[model samples]
Target: MYENLDDAELLRAALDAMNREHNADAVSLLKILVDRNPVHPYGHYLLAAEHMQLGMVDRAEEGFARAVALAPDFPIARFQLGQLYLVKGDGALAKSTLAPLADLPSGTALASYAKGLIAMVDDDVSGAVEALQTGLACEQEILPLAGDMQRLLANLMAPTEDGAFPAGVETTMSAAPLYLSAYGKTDP
Candidate 1:
């Protein structure tokens, strides 16, 4: 049934599947799409992201690297690759990988976050704070919740030199449900 759909439709379906947490189906659909069009950058990017979500780091890296190679001007792929490198403790590669993100519009949250990461890497806490504040200020219109943004700003500035963000930062981030409940947010 899917074979009859065009590339765009197939991609949409794959993205929907991925968003719905059907990684295996997303991978299957994306594999077919990529097999049909080897140079499709978005296809490779989505496939790589799905693999990453599935804990297939090696394949995810390969897909993300290929996506970056195919679309040199794309910043999101580069950001993902750079972050992956950072997670893997390849700071040098992460720095070089994220260098291009600076060329993106400074007002964008994406660019600001990338700059903040780089500043942190360079041990410039103040610079990171300033850039992040600027980014958040610039992107306020799209900020999901005003309270969340305020919390983020406060937590961001409260980090000790040795810690990443504040004490509750990682917890709220990676464990959103627990964080929300702990903060008495689960009323229903």
Candidate 2:
């Protein structure tokens, strides 16, 4: 049904579907968008997000990776890919993937998120909590991502059975799923 729409229109329709919580329709539209415009990074990114929402980790990784490969400077895509790796228990790859985000302005949400993930991988619970809190404080552009980070932070800071916090950062990645906002004319 969406085949008749041009790329821009298709993206808008997909965004509308997502806003309305019609994930299946949004996924269908995004798949068509990516198939028709294979080189558009946002299309791949959006499809990857749908895959993530559906618990299809492998597909999400592939889509996010494609998006990052097509647009190296796309910080959100890069951060998501890296976080995916971190969640999958691949710390080395996650660190490598998130490394470039360090070059972003230091106080930006993406930068803080990357730092938080890196600290988590290193088992530094306190550091991760601090960075994630900092990220939540300043996050503006991508509210969905900020919400995801907030959930992650809450999980990380949750206390253990004995009323003491966990000594190290355990992989609570599954406690919060990645939430992606729809892209507009500008790339997120």
Full-model lDDT for every candidate: 0.67, 0.80
Q: Ten-residue segment with the worst summed lDDT in candidate 2? A: 179-188
RMSD to native for every prediction?
7.1, 3.2
Weakest 10 consecutive residues of candidate 1 by summed lDDT:
179-188
lDDT of 1 by residue, 71-186 (tens): 98866678777766766667688788888886687677767767765775675657767766766776543233223434545666885877555676444333221111111111
In model 1, state the lDDT of residue 76: 68
Identify the leading candidate in terms of lDDT.
Answer: 2
lDDT of 2 by residue, 1-188 (tens): 66679998989888788778788998999999998999989889888888887889999899999999999998888988898888788999999999899668977988998998888788787888899988888846777677777777887788777644364434447534445433222334
Off by over 4 Å in 2: 158-171, 178-188
Error of 1 at 47 (Å): 0.7
Clashes of 2: 0
